[model samples]
Target: MGTADAFHSSRTHHAAQGAAISELVDRKFAGRTFGGSIRRRLQVRSHDGPSTDAGRKARQAILLVPEHEGEASSIMCGWLDASRRVAELRPFSSVRTSHKTRFGSEIDLPEAEYEAATEALRVYLSLQAFEITFEVPVEPSGRLPRPRRLSSAAEVPASAPEARASESWGLIVLAALVGFSVCYLLVLLGVIG
Candidate 1:
């Protein structure tokens, strides 16, 4: 290979231990760089919540890239309805992924969507470049939160259960918003007690 070309080389290394990883990328990529391989995986999923979760017509393809070596990244999907409006995704690091199916507007993965997903993966796998931050505060129950600036995910040392409790604040806030919306609707209809 004199000139640059995609997929310069590929190799898989199996450890002597148990099955920890399925595949590893160790070769010249896009023919532009050599060495410093990034761990990656391609996954297809029907629904995120559970087996009972709907959207049978929906399907998601996730390209998992460890932001940091050996660290797991979150899965995300962008679903487009008949109106061309993409379903809102949260805690989604990349807006490139999506859900597609025959019933929806998109029958299969489109060129642009694939390109976006690859681009996002490229950035995350980049040996160098880019930064993002988001932070939120925790308040005691039955008390209003104080104003504060937020930053991206950070390394917080907490117990296992506490860590989960903290990460779940997003759901708590969402539920509160839903409750307020319902209450407002009831008030507008003069159905409030």
Candidate 2:
């Protein structure tokens, strides 16, 4: 085979092996993938846009742009092709093309995988937060608390009956036992403690 053919063959092999971050593209997968179909991420995302003048105002985080300028078109095609191949191999799902994108790429899966992907994404995003804290806002909005008068027991209708305070009798009994124990201990000390 010619050198170009050999290169393409090697790229194909690499794409198959590397899977989600398909080696053919030489661009890191920008995530939000993995309903087991990886094609949809080949986006010129909002970040990758200066697709218009206003987009240029924002400093964007560009990811998944291929390594070399000359190979951009081929790499994009190869990346997409590889994604479709990977999508076809998904055990529990198949590629669904119904949902479209301006980027002209979509790799959806069966409904089952689509459901599971939400949880997978949740876990994925959760782990992405290395540090978490309830820090205050940089500039606090000084706002008054809105007073909401809670509904009285008398106002509750027969439908969806309000929970009776008497339902906590077991807890009250437990508290009484604890209180009795404390009283008994104090009395035993002979100081009416």
Candidate 3:
């Protein structure tokens, strides 16, 4: 195919994917408020706490958003502690945090909640390329049972140790190839055997 045809095909594929993702997100988060900008995406929820640990204080706000910019694709959902010092995530992504710490503020999620949150994150990440700005009404009452330190379904970051090691190996092979080429050229010119 021609260059123009290939470009047009690629563009069309991306557009179709975007449309499908938007539809899926609309259906998935039918009744949740959508917040965040083009660069970031999040769903904001608020409701009464289920257990005493949550306390019968003011309505607690929960945010389902990406863990961090470095792991933009990795998402977690939870509210903050009373002190607001740490983000208490339930159904937390196992994608190691920026600090490389094994543990942090996380709570275990119930099976039902885990499924719901996992579906939500999947829907969110699907439409990540486009700007999502639709807001669904938050439930006035009833708790959405959810998780804490569960493994994340997000993709591993490119900078993971395994990925870095593979890159290093590639660089070494490339350097050896370049060195062999230089030696071969010198031999051809009778400068070295």
Candidate 4:
């Protein structure tokens, strides 16, 4: 393959590997005394304004923890420690932490710094027996929203009694059909003739 093709292929491979590792970590530590695994992708943009191409970077990381091991406050503290370590390693970026009652806590850092911190966090978690993995993006500024519980389609609103009634009717129809089929079969076999 050509150089460009090879590069693209390698990038795709790397991304796939990262996703697979994330899935494995999630499966291995999702339950059983382990809090779920979290996969995060963050964007680092120029703090100056919205439409500025001055400096931007992107980073991604995954972390796993025991279920309820650390509450919000403790997680924030750990994030602060991780950010500080990242800053120590790479002094090129500024890192800030914010805590809001509604939004929880967040650590905003430069892309490079974020990547470094994520690596540091991964290592630290490993030592602490928590599984984690991370990857740095070639192009910066790609943000992924934190996962949250979403209402399933199966969920019905309290006001949607009509829909519920329809579902019940369908179930009744299904039961009637099954009953009819069983009776017909019995008659055909001379068992209930």
Highest TM-score model number: 3
Q: What are the per-residue Cα lDDT tens digits for candidate 1 across 5-122?
A: 2222211111110011111112222222211233333322222232211222332333333335554343343221111111222222232222222233332333444444445434
Give the runs in model 3 whose Cα sits over 4 Å from its true position.
1-118, 126-178, 181-193
lDDT winner between candidates 1 and 4: 4
Error of 3 at 180 (Å): 3.8
lDDT of 4 by residue, 1-193 (tens): 9975554454433233333344444554444231123333221111122211211111123332223434422222121112111211222121222222235444322344445545544554455444332222112233533543323321233336678889999999999999999999999999996
For each of the candidates, the C-alpha root-mean-square deviation to the true structure, in angstroms, is 21.4, 20.7, 18.1, 21.0
Q: Whole-model lDDT for model 4 versus the true structure?
A: 0.36
Report the lDDT tens digits of candidate 3 across residue range 1-57: 997556445443323333344344445665553323312234434222222222223
Off by over 4 Å in 1: 1-37, 46-61, 65-69, 72-193
The whole-model lDDT of each prediction reads: 0.33, 0.33, 0.40, 0.36
Error of 3 at 138 (Å): 28
lDDT of 4 at 3: 77
The pairs that clash in candidate 1 are 133-151, 133-152, 134-151, 134-152, 135-151
lDDT per residue as tens, model 2, 49-151:
2122321122211122323344322111111122211111111221232123223665333455444443342233235431111112122233433543422
